[model samples]
Target: MNYTLHQLHVFFKISQTQSITRAAEELHLTQPAVSIQLKNFQDQFEIPLTEVISRRIYLTDFGWEIARAAEKILTETHAINNRILAHKGLLYGRLTVSVVSTGKYVMPYFLSGFMRQHEGLELVMDVTNRQKVIASLAKNEVDFALVSILPQQLNVQQLDLMPNKLYLVGRRLDDSSLLSDDPGQLEKLPLIYRENGSGTRSIMETFITDHQLVVRKRLELTSNEAVKQALLAGLGYSVMPLIGIKNELLTNELQIIPIKGLPLQTSWMLIWHKDKQFSPVAQAYLSYLRANKEMIVQASFDWYQQF
Candidate 1:
């Protein structure tokens, strides 16, 4: 009948993670501590909030209802705190951003200075594939979507941040055949591709279809990091963002081939649905980004422009 807010918070995290161990790790608490709190929270109710089957925890229907309510309470509390801070001349609130997986490497640089200015603002970033990011945008779950490929169906406004160039790169092998200016030479290398629903994969597919290049699809990995690893292991070549592979290129671990239609050009964009109302924090970020985008790109991405 009576549950504490701490218990509500812990239970909400447990619901989100679906594993006591993981919830403990995220909450920075011990497994035993999480178990104890969960038990204590459950003791307040006669019915079960969570159940275990096959060693995995699943929330009960009642638990789902409670978790949803708890989320609202937590969100409202955060909003109140933000409003209080705003009265004190601080731009404070949670700024949730859903970014396509590879965008993780780039969004941070743009977000750094703006976040530094608003110390009280919290950041919640969902680094997932393009599908999930688009889904989040459709659901209005985030303040911004950092993406290279904008969704066609969504009515959104975009601010161009920096150029995103994907280059066909392979290991710095001594094979002269792998280095070619001819676009037809693309058929030679076994291509390491990102899985479907990835922006990189989409671009790679378009390039393939346009050139009528029959590529050797060696692997379809799930993430940029995975594709990079496959490349390092000499599995295959991939069209990788220069931003993600700067160190490898500098260390001579990878080399960009000189092809006619290469470095698939796109822009990193800050996108938000046209109809979504802006929170103060979101508004501040948009303003900061618009005012300082040129400067941020100059400071952080000037090296990329050489290619």
Candidate 2:
């Protein structure tokens, strides 16, 4: 009936990620170590807590109950730790952030200044698809999420960060005909699309539908990086966020095709669950963002525009 807080913490991570390997990675432990600890934790209980089906881990009812309890315990423990830090006038703690895949390009600049100012803070950044990022926020797994599109289902408090300009990009080529701005020509171009559930994909879909752009031939890729690679190879044209292709655009490896009603603009937003309590560190970071948002966006776009 006795279990260490460490075991409970690991179990909570496993439940949150739904994967032993991912939990191990997040906890900075080896997979075998995580497995051993999990086994040891289970040995203390008479009933099974988890099961694996088709390579996916599922928590039993007992495991779900334990996980819920563990989450509350861990949350309270963190709150206590934050209170102690506050009393000491220390701005030191872990700050976890989940960002959409395209955010990988620009979030570092925003985080770097904050981390430098608060040297004692630990930053944990997870870059995933929009759906997973939203899930992390909803589960209270991360302190904040950076994304272009906000979820309609979640009650979240959000700060608008910057404009996320999406452009029609392709390999730089000599044929000027490929850069036509005519919307009717869209039907003839080979369009590369992001996978379903991607925020970028959703935006692109809306743009296509709104403009009535018929994409006769499209190749669906899983990531912005993949779509960029496909474009570089002259495989197809893709509507990609400017942040993701800034380097390529600067180097002239890729060119934004001049198209009518182009460069679809969406705002990047920093969001958190409205009811979730923020730690001191999270609060400080949020304040820092509010105070420096203009400079941050300007700096990012300045860099992007330089080339």
Candidate 3:
């Protein structure tokens, strides 16, 4: 009862990040200040909330419970604030979103308009691989997730946004003989691959399997930028999202390899957990996306084509 919302907020950040340093950085507070607030909050509880083990912070059982309650309290508080703002015919609230790495290329375009319209809104975005993005959504750590491949394990509500096309690209070599539609030739070329758990990697894997094709993987990269660099360096051919490689393709820095059954097509989707209670801000964004989906997609495609 003695604890304040400020204290709860600090504790919640620490619980989420599991590191005082990171929590402090995100909270924009000095490390010592965060430590003092945490200590004071623990005094109010009169129970051990967290402990340092092997130089890493781990939450105690009580800490976990408190963190969960803190999340609910914060969410409800934000909902109430949003409702008040709605009554005033104003929009002002924070929106957190997570997207897979490939989505990074297109998500900014999708968000720019909405963000411009709501100058008072705060937007936090996490760009990670598909696995981490899905995990964040599962934990309710983010309000929405943008991805091409939806997890089969989670119950979620999704809106299809735009077409996501992936192509096989490599440095344009003078050897025209290397360019062929024969699937067997793929095994002879050095292939650049994405790290495991990448949605693009998964799709590529399936495509390879279905076609009974083979590839000589020369490198395993974790990010699109790295892969693009490797491709530019002629390290190997790679399956990459067109959005990520549009500029390269336009400039002829990267050439799409014509292969049998290639240019795999998928749809970008916006997803949220089925059990989540939407705040007014979340609802507003969702409605905005629904209304402008076609325009957004067209604008993105047009932008890419110009590159």
- Per-residue error (Å), model 3, residue 198: 0.6
Q: Is candidate 1 or candidate 2 better by TM-score?
A: 1
Best by TM-score: 1
Instruction: Arrange candidates, best TM-score first.
Output: 1, 3, 2
Instruction: Give the distance in Å from residue 136's predicted Cα in candidate 2 to where it truly belongs.
Output: 1.3
lDDT order of candidates, top first: 1, 3, 2
TM-score for model 3?
0.74
Question: Model 2: per-residue lDDT, tens digit, 1-307?
Answer: 8888899999999999999999999999999999988998999988899999999989999999989999999989878876776788879789999999989987898898999887667799999998999999989999999999889989999999888888888876466775578876677788998888998889878888888877865699889999998998999888899888877887899988877887888888999999989888899899999999899878766775542
Q: What's the CA RMSD of model 2 in angstroms?
A: 5.3
Clashing residue pairs in candidate 2 are: none
lDDT tens readout by residue for model 1, 11-120 = 99999999999999888899999999999999998889999999999999999998999999988887888779879988776899999888988899989998888888
Q: When superposed on Cα atoms, how far off is each prediction in RMSD?
A: 3.4, 5.3, 5.4
Better of 1 and 3 by TM-score: 1
Q: In model 3, which regions exceed 4 Å deviation? A: 1-87, 303-307
